[model samples]
Target: MYQESSFKHDAAPPMEYFLWIIPTGRASDAYGYSQAKTPTWSDYIRETGNNGADRDDFDDAIDFMAWFVYKTHKVNSISKWDAYAQYLNYHEGWGGYKRGTYKKKSG
Candidate 1:
């Protein structure tokens, strides 16, 4: 939450939601405190049955983040408490992490 949006509820306003795009030419579609992208958010909604979830809503954001981290652990085998690895997975999708895409970044 803090890393994603500094806990700002309106991190990505509804009208200007398309502003946050990934450098890879991918439309991030990320919004709110959780900074969750549309496809992933929809997956969360479908998986958890949280049909009314809103990214800007604190409770919903927290739930979405928790669910994401939980899924990260299940799919990536990264410990939930391992903030570093979890963050990497969070930033890079699970498939990207699995493919070592983070290692390709020229730091």
Candidate 2:
């Protein structure tokens, strides 16, 4: 349930992502952490390149994501919780997400 844009490491921010960008960062407040705010690619600055130039593939990402979903508070213990809820918790702050803001969405 990880989310991210398709912007490349060296690509300039596109207009479509402007609304997703927060103050000097993405909606998740992940600025310098992610390469171009590409959601699926987690943060690991001081590395070689985008998602790192070395370690090929999503193994690192998958491992980290597993830990994130299982270790993060609130999102883990919520009843009937699933990847969708976890995604909401991840995108919105805990307080905001716990308010059930997404329940009103048309989606």
Candidate 3:
């Protein structure tokens, strides 16, 4: 998706944890943009925070999106995806997360 690519290029590279952020951005965008007739994953990333003072929240959104994508696409096993989904739920209070698998979360 275009949005996924934008988040990867625009947001992921600047972070100390680029791998972590990409999937979060993707998942958050997937959920947040679902209502649109033509939703973009990037729009979801953009919508997660205000212009300022919510950078942490924005980061969390990115992780959430990434987690969503990881669960849905990259891994082929339901058990693995469920574990990831649980991890995201548990880590919602923080902006950081660890990847359970090494595969890139997006296409």
Candidate 4:
């Protein structure tokens, strides 16, 4: 599945391409930027609700992924292992991970 995303495993600039792929694998609806049941739109999901727009889902996902990595995770240092860790942290907020839903359940 990793290679199917068409992402190089060890990118030079350190992009966790697999992170985005995981979500796509789980939800093809991600490609349409459709939130399935949530009311979230890429254009309005930001905390301020005024800093986003209807851009490509993959690009928006990448942007949000970076936000999760450098901001939410407060990652003082990055490593390959961080990609997998932060992916869950992004999927479920850091608090959600502590609550075990992020690490335990599929939903």
lDDT of the candidates, in the order given: 0.87, 0.43, 0.37, 0.42
What are the root-mean-square deviations of the candidates from the true structure over C-alphas? 5.0, 7.8, 13.6, 11.0
Worst 10 residues of 1 by lDDT: 16-25
List the pairs of residues colliding in candidate 2.
4-39
**On TM-score, who's better, 2 or 3?**
2
Better of 2 and 4 by lDDT: 2
The candidates, ranked best first by TM-score, are 1, 4, 2, 3
Off by over 4 Å in 2: 6-57, 73-76, 79-81, 103-107
How do the predictions measure up, each by TM-score? 0.82, 0.40, 0.20, 0.41
Q: How close is candidate 3 to the true structure, as a TM-score?
A: 0.20
Please provide, for model 3 over 53-94, each residue's C-alpha lDDT reduced to its tens digit, 9 standing for 90 to 100. 222244544554555455443333334456555444333312
Better of 1 and 2 by lDDT: 1
lDDT of 1 at 104: 97
Cα error of candidate 2 at position 2, Å = 6.7
Off by over 4 Å in 3: 1-56, 74-107
Candidate number that wins on lDDT, 3 or 4: 4
Write the residue-wise lDDT of candidate 4 on 1-107 in tens digits.
Answer: 12223333221222234666542233322323222112333423555253653324445544544544665445334343577666655455556655757556654
Predicted structure 2: lDDT: 0.43
